[model samples]
Target: MPNWGEWAALAGGVPVTEERDPARDAARIEQLDPAYHHHDPSVPERIWDWIGEQLDKALGSVGVPASGISTVLLFVLVLVVLAGLLWWRLGAPRRAAGRAVALFGSGGPAGADEHRAAAAGHAAAGRWTEAVREQLRALIRGLEERTLLDVRPGRTADEAAAEAGRVLPEHAEALRRAARTFDDVVYGEHTADAGAYQALLDLDRAVTASRPTLAGSTS
Candidate 1:
């Protein structure tokens, strides 16, 4: 068979080093086929050429190993997964968490038109809870897209309000009050009527117009 150092170097686009260990590559060849050891020199050359082709293809699909692009890609994937997990564990705001939830949907959470249709469905069915839930969800989604507030259901209202306040201290009290109202209607024992719904709609609009800061606020 071919010299392991030459083959590995050809595959890796590196020079064969005299001090390099060849036993590992040799063992790999042995696993492929123990009979390969008996092959002629031409056979080993062809095999190395094939390995070179494969490495070339792998490199093209990604990039040169110089940038550690493959390693960085793996690291990025791991970081994305970890970030998603952290958002989940920390009870990211409804808006923030929806990003993860959207992954479960066929084409992601329904678009605005779809949401409107769903809201209409809830309204037609007279399912106040469902209608309110849908509206609240839409509001949260809009806020997130606009970078107004990073709301998530897993996060408490106080936490969300605090975040909103930090992002827009000028509207902090208003945000806090709105959050309190939302909590009361959505989770409290009180029944939310048309007036409450209107109030929520108003709050959503106000928050949208606030031109709030980014989620990462110093306060």
Candidate 2:
């Protein structure tokens, strides 16, 4: 009968005789560097390479020379960058205008007294648009003071007209027309005249004499 080692050898099993050498194994691993086996590029390099390949293919299809394609791409990139910057800058004024409309509707005056004074001053200067805007503000403020209309923050002229109209049904049409006039001057960029200013002034006076209706009653 064969010995265990001989039997194992005959069965094609090798005996574990050699001990693992940590330092030598590490050195061997370093010599056979795994990094060299990994042929894939880094993320940014891969992205740039992919973009270049796609660009080359596209330009080639259009019969554009590879040399000129780079210049065209650079020009397109510059245009994209400039467009982004322009949008960022010009967006501010529109946003500010929207914020102003939300905060004070057309524009803000200090108070009803200040608005009335400013309206008078504008009227004297023949700035009818400014006069009309200030007068409307004065009218809205007066209604707010009398508790005829609840104090609404960020109220537009149209909204004020509707609320005030519900309370003063007699002047509803006039109020709506006056509000439209104010909106036309402020937002529509239309010019105002003496007739428009006088109409707003008349509406302002009428609002002052108006009384609040019963709670939850349009009548």
How many residue pairs clash in model 2? 0
TM-scores, all models, native as reference: 0.38, 0.50
Residue-wise C-alpha lDDT for candidate 1, range 1-219, written one tens digit per residue: 758868887999987556756898888877788476566568789997786667667876876663564575678689999998876544436444333232112343444335545655776777655555455555556656665554344555556657767766776776566555555445433455665555556665676677666556554
Q: For each candidate in the order shown, give its overall lDDT on alpha carbons.
A: 0.59, 0.79
How much lDDT does candidate 1 score?
0.59
What TM-score, to 2 decimals, does candidate 2 have?
0.50
**Which ten contiguous residues of candidate 1 have the minimum total lDDT?**
97-106
Clashes of each: 6, 0
lDDT by residue (tens digit), candidate 2, 72-139: 98999999999988765444454343443531454567577778888989999999888988888888
Candidate 1 lDDT at 64 equals: 67
Q: In candidate 2, which residue pairs clash?
A: none
